[model samples]
Target: MATLSSFLLATSLVLAGCAGGGGGNASGTAGGGGTAGKPHVLKVANYFATDHPQNVALREKFKPMVEEKSGGSLQVQIYDNSKLGAEKEFYDGVRNGTIEMGIPGLIMQADVPKMAVGEWPFLFKDFAHAKKVLEGPIGKEMTDEMESKHGVHALAWSANGFRMFSSNRPIASVNDFQGMRIRMPNIPNYIKLGQLLGANITPMPISEVFTALEQKVVDGQDNPIATLKASGWYEVQTDVLESKHMFSPNLYIINGKLWSQLTPEQQRILEEAAKAAADYEWELLEKSYEDDKKFLQEKGIRFTTPDESFRQAMETAAGPLYDEIYQTYPWAKEMVEKIKAEAK
Candidate 1:
């Protein structure tokens, strides 16, 4: 009798533990705590400021959409303005699975050289053209390589807008570029572009840009007008040239391991939320340009829209840089051709 009672107690305890596990609303695909019916936490990181359209889109669209759609099984936490770390830091975190998600610029071009095309000088004709190419088949081709090589999966493409030149003096033509000190990202394309334009390039990270501008470490910096307003770089810049030399885009990526752990329904909800948020950011950013330009003007900053001649001159000077890129990467030439063809 005693032996039978012991076996029965053991069986009862085992059954109770299994029952306590709670079958977890399709989170059965995940391991450990996630299978115990706990809400899966996803941390989203980015360097964009809180008021910037990127953060606004994430907060208003992504968070609410994912949580509601998952019926409280998925929770999203967003860290904006380098709250977690700078672009590279969070990017590395995502790649290593330390961070669930990140919105980063094409900094991955350092590892994934093909990504450089995203920022090729004078490549994208306009906002619409860039968006079409990036969100179309070409973007998928590029991002597929990213998933296979790197450990992150691309969710959606967000807006960084076009790169504009901001300076203390007017840059109305190519002549103004000569001997000017300009800040550029350490990326070779950016440096080569600045060098081609006859400026002395000071390669630095974006985090250090404002101090460099304030201390006059460099004469000017180039970034999207949205970034100009978000980072408060406009306070130091007295003039802005709507140069639109390059179209910069941000990517919403999730760690491959974390993404794989999500159930199909959870993955679908996250992907849908990402696209919605990306579209939201794009709309908000486009509408913000004129408002940012107007605010900069009201702040005693001069805004210059370069004429067609000046634009042509800059593009002409950049021809060799593109030629050199084609020589370096066998696939680059074809990619550019495809991008241009698709733009039409």
Candidate 2:
């Protein structure tokens, strides 16, 4: 008889308990670090730039609300731009209880391979379709498995937006993907997609991408367009392929062990704040796409929208990969069907 709200709250009771290292230079904080009546400090780690919506939401929504609503019993300290570490490192930090919380992407699939569903290329129809599936039963099903098997818990699903390709050259057709040297995060979904599209996939971490692009080590890279703007990758990149090839969602996660230690009231406050912050990020990012495209245009970054034929070709290229997924995860076919059904 539990409603969705109750389920989310229960799942998010999977939040912080580990006190992070000192917070003297954290991106945002509502309390002094002097330790008077010492509130519980929740250390949040993410790799997004300080100005990115992820950090903005955390600073604007999550930090303040958790601090205020908990009546200062809980304090949030945000470490933006890998201040704690990169995606995998911070993720491991959360898993081992060295850190309290994080917003990592498909890197989580390393531990929980099924989590790959989030970044599967060309799977999502659009933002609304994604929201329905990931926040509904399907998403809960995945996150529930994630929490039980992995050590981190999902607080809420936030937007990373749809990914676009930016490069030194234009991606005008499915043929352009052939032999293109594209940088991809070292996850199987990305690697397989790139290979199938005939891209010469170059795997690397996000931190090294700028240098790689500037040095011509790779032809291009993929990320949300807003990320292209926020990370300032546009300075060296000349064109964007509005592929929207994949939609990646960032889950605000807390240490599973730490989550269990919190009192019910504290858990409720954190859950509300986390979801509110995630929603705020989604709002900011949805608006940022067009705004960011305009900004990129102003900077002389050209844009390309794949026409119907090209899109179909790209989807066809992805067909074999989906077969592999279905073969690997017995339930992926059913889950994917459920996802497609939502679009109708």
Candidate 3:
């Protein structure tokens, strides 16, 4: 009888231990204290000011979604206004994994000349044409090229709207630009456009443009009306031409390796968030142009709309530059032709 009782006691103890073991696991799965998984902290970097509405909207819309989807396992931090460094440096940081995210102007990729085709002055006819090209295979090719060559993955496409000509002299026709010193972003097509018009191309960073214009280093620079007003360029500039010369695209890129390392679930969240942000950016683009034009008129800034004849003259002058760029990168010509065909 004593031996039987001891056996029963041992069995009861073993079953209790098993039950306790199962309970502990269930508690851990429920995210119990002392055994929960570590949280992931993501850092986003951009050259836009922290107060920029785009940045603010992105954080407000996506930050909470990330935390919720990760079950409180992820947190995102945003650093803006080159709080890190120049735009190029921020791009390099993301490429090398020092920074996890970066938003750089499409023209900035002119550092990799093949990418300059997107910002080629007079290349895109309007927003609709540009959108068809950028969201189509041509843009995809450039995005893939950046990944293969620079180890970065592009997210979504956005824009800075159309660029206009701003200078002290009123530009009523293409001939008016002869011998003028025009500020050119460090992009090849822009320089070519200026050269075609007989203007001296002054290559400088956007941050230095105000001082350059104030000091008469450049007779003027080209940018969207919104950017011209937001950047305070009008304070030093006297005339604005609604040339609509080119459209600027803004791209968000991440390090390829880091992106691949993310879990599929995390990747999905990011892609969806980026698409939403792209839509929001488009809305902002429309409002920005409208608000800016009103403000510029009220500020007594002169606005001129070049006639069709004048537009054709400028385009004709840039024809050779386009040919040169096409010759240098034959692939660009093919892509542009392909985009044109798709639009038709």
Candidate 4:
């Protein structure tokens, strides 16, 4: 009888322990103590400053929409101001899944050589033409190639606007570029374009540009007006030439492995959010150009609008590069032709 009573007592104790453990788990799940599966965390990186339109859209619109749509199952963390890394490092991080997403600037050509065609001097007629080509069949082909060749997926194409020359001296004509020391990004196409324009090239990171201009390390730098204003280059620059030399595009990319890990519903939500952010950023570009130009004028910067003859001179000088580009990358010519045809 004692043994029977002891067995009953042990069984009751085991049942009580089970019930206690289950109750603890329920409490944890209810109180957000991680008993429920942890939400997936996505890290997005960009080199733009926080106040830049792209970052603003990503942080304000993209993040909230994604979180709300996912019902707290997904969380987006943005690292702006190159917090994650510089352009090349950001691309590497995203490709390797160390960073889930990135919007890298001119450094993309380092990974996919054919991408250089997109930034070819005088290639894009205007923002609308550029957008139409990049968002159409040609863009899809490039994105597919990116996925197949590199371990990255392109989500959207956004712009950095047309690059203009900012300098201490006025550039009213092509002759004004003679013997000028200009800061170019560490990219071959940029170097080539600077050389073609008869400027002494000083290849440097974008971060060093302002100091370089102030200290006279470089006579001038070329970038979108918004970037020039945002980087405070206008403080040292007295004149801007509306060259519209290159229309730089920023690609929102995701790590292929990380993308594959997401559920279909989650992927759809992310894709839609990315598209919305890109569209919003595109709309901001026109306003940014007007606002930045006005702000620069307020700061006593003079604007030089180059005439058609000057533009024609530039086109003639840089046109030979098309053949050189075609020879260098086997697929480049075809892509360039496709974009050109689409633009028309």
Candidate 5:
């Protein structure tokens, strides 16, 4: 039997080959320009399943648009299901130009901690407000900082939906979260949030979450409803609380070196395609969330809707972290204020 580590390694190598090997040429001409025969192959990596809305948009919409606009000058190869690597690995691959593009998750906060401000517990009014703040000046500033400091260019940001808590045990109120062992991504802000919520934070990669849950290593985990369903986490989790505590947006990033290598026309095509794909995915988010919720209910996962008093208690508990975040990341205060001002 193949171990998980070995399976991941083999998958990475196979996908790497597919990304690097330009199997065919539209024409024989060879040059930087997208002339007759020389086509620029852009490899895009994502951790989502092939059926996920984001992947569907990339493969069906983004790829076709970029290819058509480039007039056979560009070919896009997408590696879904973490074929390239995990979220952090994907970011590293893009930064080093091993991968041309990736939609790395909030792990991007490691590069630009100011992004943590956008994810404050119960920050935005809803998804539309979150979208507005991100697509506005605040998002641009974050993108600029990333490109300037991290050597990765942000193409566009798309919705990852609001994160909710799922547990093996019922969590009907804020008091129920006290001392609960909760699995969280290994990111500073997330750790802090879990701490503020009175959870015994257990940081682990997303891939290990299921096993952790089944073995009862952690009492609960949090993710968007769609993610819980898509990842089959509902099978392990019995109760879900609609905390809607954080709104996460996935950023599509390209290597700075790779971006610089592209012709101005090529860059425009890629950027436009990314934007279009982002919009398409955002359109699907609400429906996907609703469908996933229905699916979970049908599968017998108990759901909890927090009362106003419970929500207030959660907010009160997490509010102090705002000052802590500002102290840790100097720019975070300003970004948080900007996003709050923009949020409806």
Candidate 6:
């Protein structure tokens, strides 16, 4: 087995091939853009704010390591806040080989519907369980499938934790959600979950979420508390219902054709850098939850932990949606079952 260092070296070589011409931009060379001898410049596209802790953590932890290890041979250029277009657009860009890499949601069904298998609502019990499945065999299989079917290769999996609910009105039970309009990702499973819980679901891009709440386009939205605080949604919505629903797992993907063309040494470097960033980002996410909640609390955001009965009720109501997902992808169902069995 190749070590993590070997993976980054191999990835660097792959990136070099994508650049076509041998010369490298000074800005994209090494950390500051090195000389022409550098393998390739890595353009990393993400929709998060440049200052967001996760993004900061990723850069602080991974970028320098990749550059130094590659001896200023790989350049990493990060574009934040949808500079490379939104999540779906980034996915398409990677597929078309327009973008070298991006971190996109599993819900991008248009580009890779099979990847959406992991986003089925309420599939995970908690964070640890989520990590087990995502970093384990099931995720590996899906990652392999993505490379084969979509010309995308997964470098690592990052978490957004289990998503929760936030609204202007206090949401203590499923009853409180009745007639509420909740903004959700443009995914069928999300729509079904809202419907199951008696909320009118409004599907939209993540960028529009805060605005929708402020404009009353939706009465509520579901996401991790960390996101609600980080994105400044608390300014518009005062009440938070901590209903850990779906675990939003993001994929750090590179164009497969581009990745395959790299020399093994360069590839090794990119993989090492990605793994380090993944671990760093996840740790930041875990720590951010408490700090985020505390900050929201200080800002006068009301936090409501729903009763056990309500959680069970919501899960039961949404259970049928799982059946629909299973019907859509029987192989994923099998993989999920195997994961559940192993968790025992």
Which residue segments of model 4 deviate by more than 4 Å?
1-38
User: For model 3, which pairs clash?
Assistant: none
Give the C-alpha miss distance for residue 19 in model 2, angstroms.
Answer: 33
* lDDT value, candidate 4, whole model: 0.84
* Alpha-carbon lDDT of model 3: 0.76
The candidate that wins on lDDT is 1
**Candidate 4: clashing pairs of residues:** none
Tens digit per residue, CA lDDT, model 5, 1-344: 46988999999999888766654332333433543233678889987777778898898789999889888888899998788888888888988888988997767677676666567788888878888988888778767678777789988998778899999989988788899999988887788888988899999877788899999999999888878887888889899999999887898888998788777778888889999999999888767887888899999998899999998998888887887877777777777777778754
lDDT of 4 by residue, 202-264 (tens): 988676787999999999999899888878888998999999999888888899988787767
Cα shift from native, residue 253, model 6 (Å): 0.6
Worst 10-residue lDDT window, candidate 5: 23-32
Q: Which candidate has the highest TM-score of all? A: 1
Query: Which residue segments of model 3 deviate by more than 4 Å?
Result: 1-39, 49-53, 60-64, 107-114
Model 6, which residues run further than 4 Å from truth?
A: 1-38, 110-114
Candidate 5 collision pairs: 27-37
lDDT winner, 2 or 6: 2
In angstroms, the error of model 6 at 50 is: 2.8
Winner of 1 and 3 under TM-score:
1
RMSD (CA, Å), candidate 3 to true, equals 4.0
Candidates in order, TM-scores: namely 0.89, 0.88, 0.85, 0.86, 0.87, 0.85
Give the Å error, residue 157, model 6.
Answer: 0.7
> 143-186 in candidate 2: lDDT tens per residue?
87677778788899998999988999999998888888999989
Query: What lDDT score belongs to each candidate, Candidate 1 first?
Result: 0.89, 0.86, 0.76, 0.84, 0.83, 0.79
Q: Which parts of model 1 have CA positions greater than 4 angstroms off?
A: 1-38
Give the per-residue lDDT digits (tens) of candidate 3, residues 245-331.
777777877778888876666666667676677657666766667678888878878999988898888889888987887777767
Q: Which model, 3 or 5, shows the larger lDDT?
A: 5
Could you tell which candidate, 5 or 6, scores higher by TM-score?
5
lDDT per residue as tens, model 1, 1-344? 99999999999999988776766533554433332234688999998888999999999999999999887788999999898888889999999999999999988887788777889988888878888999998888777778878889999999899998999899989989999999988888999999999999998878889999999999999999888888999889899998899998999999998888787778888899999999999999999999998888888889888899999999998998998998988988889999998768
